[model samples]
Target: MATTTEADIHITKGHEVLKLYQFNTHTARHYFCSVCGIYTHHQRRSNPQEYGFNVACLEDVDPFELGEVPLGDGVNHPADRN
Candidate 1:
């Protein structure tokens, strides 16, 4: 996942490339590339200030090289408890 501030993400190429999908609580939004059908990023419900992005969409970056990716407990997410 790419850790970046909301302002850092610039859509230089595909301005209309993403399609949004909302599920469950509907607080978070999942964005997919409309052309290739690839998951690009999502607005985090837990932390609305941040965005969770797919590292594969980044230029010249390999996810395997990042090392030790931590998984979030989505099944027990605090938002779902209510």
Candidate 2:
């Protein structure tokens, strides 16, 4: 996932077809393409100031090229602890 600040993300197009999904406390906002149901990005619950986007969604970007990607621990979400 590639990250950007909340102020930096600008959806120039296809904003109409984006579907939002929220879970638990509903603090996080996850967006997906309404047509094909592919994940687009999400406003992070852990860090509301940032948005995490699916890097695979971008054109000509190979995940393999970005070796040893770091992973987050989702099972122990901060919201759940709170």
Candidate 3:
């Protein structure tokens, strides 16, 4: 995952570079690079106010250097419950 602050994220250069996809509930959107097919980021379903991005897309940053990333239980997302 990419380390991002909500206000810091923006698609500065490649406005048309990525393709978008969403499935089932259509609550989240996944973006991928059209040329390289790299998963770039997603409009998170759990928190539409934020985005989840791929660390690989970040320039000059190594995800391993961040240490101990936490995982979330998307399968049991609270929003899905009544």
Best by lDDT: 2
Q: What is the lDDT of residue 38 in candidate 1?
A: 92
Q: Which stretches of candidate 2 lie over 4 Å from their true place?
A: 72-82
Worst 10 residues of 3 by lDDT: 1-10
Preferred candidate (lDDT higher): 2 or 3: 2
User: What's the TM-score of every candidate structure?
Assistant: 0.74, 0.77, 0.72
Best by TM-score: 2
- Name the lDDT value of residue 74 in candidate 2: 67
Give Cα distance to truth, residue 29, candidate 1, Å: 1.6
lDDT of 2 by residue, 1-82 (tens): 8999999988867899999999988998999999999999999988899999988877789988999998879687545665
Off by over 4 Å in 1: 72-82
**Candidate 1 Cα RMSD (Å):** 2.6
| lDDT on C-alpha atoms for all candidate structures | 0.81, 0.90, 0.79
Candidate 1 TM-score, C-alpha based: 0.74
Q: Deviation in angstroms for 27 in model 2?
A: 0.7
Each candidate: RMSD to true structure? Answer: 2.6, 2.5, 3.0
Q: Poorest 10 consecutive residues of model 1 by lDDT?
A: 73-82
